[model samples]
Target chain A: MDLATCLKKMELVGVLAFATVDSDGAPQIRNISAIHYESDAIYFFTARGKNFCRELLEDGRVQILCYTKYKEMIRMSAKAYAVPEEEQAKWRDIIFEEQPYLANVYPGDTRSIGIIFCIDRAEVEYFNLGVNPIFRDTYTLGGGTITKKGYNITEKCIGCGKCRTKCPQRCIEEGKPYRILQNHCLHCGNCYENCPVKAIVRE
Target chain B: MDLATCLKKMELVGVLAFATVDSDGAPQIRNISAIHYESDAIYFFTARGKNFCRELLEDGRVQILCYTKYKEMIRMSAKAYAVPEEEQAKWRDIIFEEQPYLANVYPGDTRSIGIIFCIDRAEVEYFNLGVNPIFRDTYTLGGGTITKKGYNITEKCIGCGKCRTKCPQRCIEEGKPYRILQNHCLHCGNCYENCPVKAIVRE
Candidate 1:
């Protein structure tokens, strides 16, 4: 799936698990549904006094993840910042209107205590397990950059095919230097660990 | 629910979401089922080369969470450390015996690539949304300290009953200093924000 499809899937899932680092340096997570998705960004609401809000304000780094029923895992990593003062109300109203249940938590004027934060740029990872041998890809929203992962065979290859034999997905191909099929790789590092010649390098 | 009950519930759920902070301080999370629970501790397995394993090794702080079908949210915040090198194989074998599917991922001696980690101290929070007004409580396992949360009315309470009127749970009681029923509190800060006297303090 592409960037837009990933965003659309997250919208369809509605609620997602959000992870953030607290002031004490421990990881904290909770399920949040108060979100308004944009083609290139995501806006969510949290009370100003809540720890979730404080964490976001102090350190904007956050990760939003969802595991769909079809065994697709979508994760977005980005820094979230509160909307500009002038546009907070506009975005908050849009979210509250979309998520009616939120009214019960912050009725009427109480909603003013809530703040809206936006993720304008993020690295999104799409990993699907429903397909045999699995499949994974990375995409960037806005200007976020993708982090390279998985293993690659180097020129140090002896062509012993040891990496191919140990690969759970059997994704390694023989040549002067073995080739790893990136799309179907599990990134489990089985081949990397078993390579007799240390010819594999992590990307 | 008590600590044991919460642990048992997590065991029944099989797979749970684990959140951690990577080297870059970005939040990372994944669903893991390779777990074994004890009366006051938890043991789990992860491959040594995976990012998840690297994060745990570098920073032991972690949060494990599971949301049940009955709208119960159970979260455990703790620092996890790799089991003693001498005992690693013993725990890993026990986990593999309990979780047969793991054999498919690391068959035969390849399992040696995995490592076991233990969480012997933790503060567990149980929050249930199935009940009206909600319910929440905290428990410590293996002497982990609980971090105080929610708000409390101080002697500055004016007896105006304004906090009570605004409390969604309506759990505040009339007194010289209004008392907040901690167990039933949503910790949403509605009363704290609406209090005219500003008598409420976060616990």
Candidate 2:
């Protein structure tokens, strides 16, 4: 439920899947083992010569995922930034010390090509499928926002009450335009599809 | 390895991460448990009203990923299409039978809202991180093309030979425009970034 618990679960995962956007505008993903944990940030290193590095530099947005044996998945999305020169050595040393195997890939002098990046602000979604009806929740750290998701009603609503009859969650509130309780929303576009007047919009 | 071995490893993963492009063009990922594998296709079911279902209906492009306990990753990219309405009942029954837990969520008549999708032509990538230097390979099934990735020389090559020296895979061949062995290429992009004339094109 807390970041520490999430970090501990991720550590058990051993390897993490990191995703980036390639030059061709397609999502590229690869496994990485150079991740290090900090009190408030997730740190990872990549060689400047790698496409993964170039993608990060071109667009800082990234999503890293780890799934544990317990059938729980923690997915974190953040805007990544390089560790500044002033603090690179500090974080790099901490990371290198934790991930000793990295030395095999970038030995001695070649280590200079390594770049350290930190995701200071992240939107983390913890999902558990261990139960019958899967559970999921979102957490924001370091000022990241948990954007509102699901369908919304427009002012054009005829208040036909058709949407209210079909909503599985029944979290819709009647007003000039029906409002959906996003936190309880299943993101099931039932109202959107069944609305006769087409007053629903994906938010 | 063969697709059989790949699917077995995927089964051990228990859950798979499925990626779909949202209306905003950003990749959205979520855990799925209703997957059923076949000789030439992978099938999964989702509620017709879910955003995930809408995404697949709007754009058939999809990517499904599974990472094993041995630090191996099998990612498949494919075009998903709904099972023909005539065959939906057959496949849906098979899915519900295989995944009994699904009936708990949508018991009785609610099960009709579930939609089944099949990915027949998939480009699969097998990646291993249990060892140093890492390892990766590509596989295609059902007539899907294995795409060429990494860097390539352009008309501006200038034949400076700087890139050839920097190539780590040693898969580059000498020519008017140096060629990178598509299969052996690591996609590290070392040559792409090291080109003195910036003549490398990333595909």
Candidate 3:
């Protein structure tokens, strides 16, 4: 529903899938749970020698995704960076304290080979499919910006109701321009492609 | 355990997370379930206008990930392409037949707007965290080549057994030049980082 609720849902989902681009421009993904969540940011741990670490260092752009049992998808798009050298240990310790299972993977001094990366700003998208028409929205954490999407009806609408009929969610309503209920829109582009007068424009 | 079995597991898991690189080289991900699987290949459907489709058209590279409840992660790294024009309808029909729920989303003629993508060759990596020492291995489907990973001990091994002690899996054996049991290896690189004689090399 909001940035805080989305972050809470991600934490409740536990392990999340993180995606990043490799040097070859190919996408790589792995499940990661060694994370410490803050009110406005997230810090996660990865071994320094791992490809996951190299990918993060070479390309800070990353996407974290989680699908809850209730069919809610919380996706965070952000750039990740290694924590400040002086603060790495603090964050790493906090994560380790939270995820005790990590101790089995890197015991004792071996943890020194690990590094902590932080995502301080992100555009969090919350998409819920559990309801009838579906619901979606974007929120910013730490002042991050969101990319505008979906379709809008222009004033050129002849009110033929073609777009409304084709809309899967039936979110379009009768008006001067035929209002599209953004909250329930699927962004499936059905209405955009079916508009007879070409009045719908992508936002 | 093998490529075929892994594919079956993914089918059982239903919706999978697909990760791709956008035109700006940033990572993007979405959940996809409109899939049809074969013994050696996979076919999936997505809207032609979605960013996921554009990314595939531009870069072809993709990673399909599914995490099972038993803690097994099956990741398929491959290149995807729009099915040939003549064959698109065939694959699309098969997928829609397999996934009846798709009808609710794109009823009647609306399904024509969707495009079918295929991955005929892939390198599948199976990591099972549900087991002790974390079993992992890679397999190829449709004659795909795999990028070797993890560490190997070279002939320069001094047999000091330091590598074995540091190995979390204890999979390294004492020998003239220590051998790493690839099947049980965690690939954490602890043995490689601590090798005093620099006998370890990444595969």
Model-by-model lDDT, in order? 0.87, 0.76, 0.88
Considering summed lDDT, which 10 consecutive residues are worst modelled in model 3 chain A?
A104-113
* TM-scores for the candidates: 0.92, 0.78, 0.94
lDDT of 1 by residue, B1-203 (tens): 79889999999977678999988877898877899988878999988778999899999889988877677889999999999999999999999999886776666776887889999999999988667667899999999998988889998988999988777667889998999999888777778888998999987
- State the DockQ of every prediction: 0.52, 0.28, 0.61
TM-score, model 3 to reference: 0.94
Kindly list the per-residue Cα lDDT of model 2 for residues A123-167, writing each as its tens digit: 888876565445667887787888666678999899888877666
Q: What is the TM-score of chain B alone in each candidate?
A: 0.97, 0.81, 0.95
Top DockQ hit: 3
The CAPRI quality class of candidate 3 comes to: medium
- Give the C-alpha miss distance for residue A159 in model 3, angstroms: 3.2
Query: Least lDDT summed over 10 consecutive residues: which range in candidate 2 chain B?
Result: B127-136
* Residue A167 displacement in candidate 2 (angstroms): 7.8
lDDT of 3 by residue, B102-197 (tens): 877777877887899999999999998777777898999888898988788999999999988887667888999999988888777788889988
